[model samples]
Target: MVSRRVRDIEYAIRDIAVIADQVKKKGKKVYHLNIGDPLKYDFKTPKFISEALASASHSGKNFYADSLGVYELREEISKFLKHKDNLDITSDNIVVTMGVTEAIYFLLAAMIEKGEELLIPGPTYPLYINNTKFYDGVPIEYELNEQDDWEPNLDDLRNKITDKTQAILICSPNNPTGVLFNEKKVKKIIDLAGEYNLPVLSDEIYDQITYERNYVSPASLSKDVPVIGMNGFSKAHLMTGWRLGYIYYHDPENKLLDLKEGIAKLARARLSASSIAQYAAIEIFKTKSNHTVEMVRKLRERRDYSYKRLRQIEGINCVNASGAFYLFPKLDLSGLKKWKNDKEFAIDLLKKTGVCSVYGSGFGKYGEDHIRLTFLPELSILEEVYNHIEDFVR
Candidate 1:
């Protein structure tokens, strides 16, 4: 028998991979645009980082790490925030986990009681919604206006906050939509959270991947509000398989000590993240490399090409993503009487054309009629993928 929480959890990003695998068994090639992993395409993890991991492992650094994290790595993260974001965070306030996924799980477990709510963006990364459900917590979605570059509808956000709301979650250069939130909106969110005396869970996983300059962290802008900033080497450093991420607590007043303790307790329970990866990451943060700059340049080229081609399609409309590698395009299924929803359209497209994509509704309620696809593939491959999608639509 399955538990209700397990039954209700739907991670459409990976769920569609099963179908693609089955389709591959029939000798059809599947263009995997469904997931956001960059390494699956043209990207490669830096040689130095890999070497660091090998050196650590070879030297017998194979034992379990400190549950909080390696002191040297956490110290690097602290200096990273100081230099990059100008946020005065110390190593004691940071806890490393098995990626931001575990950081989120630990946060939910520590903070959410049954029926409490987490204010999150609609059309969000699915993990927030699924994890909240697993904790028996409510995910109150605030609208991001597609007509206005997917910025948070501040009025809608303000209206959604209630007494039961636990924390506000935001992902910049957001997944699925890939639109970066502007500075004015970021400040507004911090202001709102301050007014409510609530913590802001800021997911900055894609902070370094932006096309534009001057990306600000919510923690940097806040003076009194508690901002739990989450980031990792996965996206910025091309270390997705490393399973290393950390959350830094920013409470200038030193008010949220209990919450920090809760996270620490959970970290101790799990022992620690990958020790070899943590050792590698310490070197990653210490060294300055042009790898992300080159990665962004290539990704931008792919993004531009994919966005232009998707816009040319007759029945699709997409907001140009400024950061990250995803493009969430609204599909015009009205004329296509055969497909009832995005899921049906995606499945049929995959079966017919061997192009795999995650349907929009998998993200949240507001994501219906849309299909989220990544622009992480090479231009030549993307050209073929778009051609198949256009033909399928026609």
Candidate 2:
């Protein structure tokens, strides 16, 4: 029998793809805009990074790596953080994971006791909520004001904190919404965590994929708060399938020794991330590459075009995304009375128009009446997707 915990976990982002496949078998074309995979679009990984992986495999570097990570790769990551965010992280403080997904799992597994609460943003990436439930922990959601460009509501966040709260999670260049939390908001969250003596888990996988100026990492701004910053090459380097990511713990006062040790224990149990990928990731920090710059430029064009198109639609409205590649547009269902909710509308749209998008309610309650779409497709494809959506809505 499956455990109740396993049965209770829900991943809405990929769940709709099952229905999409059934549609495809019936001779319909499906434009996959549901997932945040850059490779599905025009993005490509850098050749140097791929060549490094090939060379490492050819040269017998396939042995099991250190549980924490390949030391050289960890060192390179430390240096990259220093250069990019002015963070003084060390190799010893980093743990390599299969991806940011694993990093989140390890962090939650190590920190969350049964019934403890994790304060997360509503309409968040589903992983945080799912992982919390997997450990029998409670997920407390704070609001993200759509009227304020998806900025987190600090007052709502403060009200949600209780003695049972274990930690706080922040996803800058956030998934589903593509909203980047500014420096002021980041600092306020850190302050709240510090006051409550809770650690902060920062997901920065899309840090380099921003359309605007570079974002400030919360760890860099933190003085005494314990921060666990998670990042990987999946989004920025166009290496989602490679499954290489790392988490760095920063505690200036050494207060989080127990939490750090817990993460290390979990890392050892997993053995290590991909050895070949680690060696290749080392090459990523060593070489100067323009792949990310070019990728962001293309994404910016798509984002602008799609945002403009969505706004023109009579019943659709969305805030312009400043970072990442998603736009969560609110749908006015009054005009089209056939659908009951966003999910129903999304599935019907898929059947009728062949555009696959995840409904907003799947993210959280605040996500109701909205649908999340990736602007990752090229301009021409996006034009077609929008035309179909506009027609479907009308």
Candidate 3:
């Protein structure tokens, strides 16, 4: 029998990838808009960062780094956050993990006790919910305001609070939805955290991938609340395979000392992250500016074109994402009595039109009638995928 801890865990994003693999085995070409791996779509990591990795690997700098991270990477990360978000923290406050995925696991395990609650946004990244369940913690999802371009509903959020709630989890320029949490909602979230004396675990993994709105870290805006900031080089730097991510503790009232200690203890048990990747990260922070700007520009163009095309389709409702590389379109399946849910819609579309996507239910119940597709592909490929999806839906 499988352990209960391992049951009920599902990643719909990659689950469809498994189907795509099977389809490819039959010599069929599948157009993937499913996963967010940029490298799979011709977005190469910049040469300078790769050169740093090469140098480190050859120079015998490949030994185990500090448990949290190498000094150079940590120091660069501190300076990088200071420059990017104006969020002040030293290297000591940071703990490096395999990726934001691991950082999320560590944070959930450290903060949530058995049967305790961690508040998360509905239609979130999904990893938060899975990790909470794995750690024997309950996840309480407050809805993101889909009616208002997927903004945060503070009243709904406040009503969801309970004595069991430990921390509030957030994702800005969010996944699945492809929208930022609004400023007013951001202020209210921080205020509630302060009032409840709870920690705010903010995932800023896509902080630099904005199109219209300026990116601001939730940790930068909080006054005295403990902001457990999670970020990484995966999205912004095209270092998905590098598997380097970090978490920082902003325990202004010295309230998070024990939690920080617990995180570091876990870090020590795991030992160091990839030493070569750490060295590469040092250079990545140094060389991130131009590459990021160009990438964002390209992504914005793709976002605009894809949104326009999706909007033109009948029975499709989209929020027109302002940031990130996803287009989450709500399909009007009222007339299609054959399809029962988002997953059925997505799977049938794949079998018929060879366009791959993840269903909205995979994210959470909030996205039940929707499906998320990435615009990370080249403009031509995106145009083709959109055409195929539109024709199939019609």
Q: What would you estimate as the lDDT of candidate 2?
A: 0.91
Model 1 scores worst on lDDT over the 10 consecutive residues at: 211-220
Error of 2 at 359 (Å): 0.7
Q: In terms of TM-score, how similar is model 2 to the real structure?
A: 0.99
Runs in model 1 with CA error above 4 Å? none
Report, for all candidates in order, the number of backbone clashes: 0, 0, 0
Superior candidate under lDDT, 2 versus 3: 2
Query: What order do you get sorting by TM-score, best first?
Result: 2, 1, 3
Question: Model 1 misses residue 3 by how many Å?
Answer: 2.3
What TM-score does candidate 1 reach?
A: 0.98
Model 2 Cα lDDT, one tens digit per residue, 1-394:
9999889888888998998998899899899999999998888888898899999999999999999999999999999889999999989998999999999999999888899999999888888889999999999999999988999999999999999999999999988789999789999999999999999999999898887767889998899999999999899899999998989988899988888888898988888899999998999888988999899888899999999999999988899898988999998888768899999999999999899999899897888999999999988999999999999988
Mark the 10 consecutive residues where model 2 has the least summed lDDT.
Answer: 208-217
For model 1, residues 253-308, the per-residue Cα lDDT tens digits are 98789999898999999999999999988998777789999999999999899989
Question: What is candidate 3's TM-score against the reference?
Answer: 0.98
- Residue-level lDDT of model 3, residues 1-394, one tens digit each, is 9998888898999989898888878887799999888888878899998999999999999788899888878888888888877878999999888999889988988888999998999887889889999988998888987789998778888898899999998898889899977877887899998999889999988888988788878888887999999989899889999898999887777899889899899999988889999887888766635888888988888899999999999888899887778889998889666699889999988888789999999998888999999999999998888889778877
lDDT of each: 0.92, 0.91, 0.88
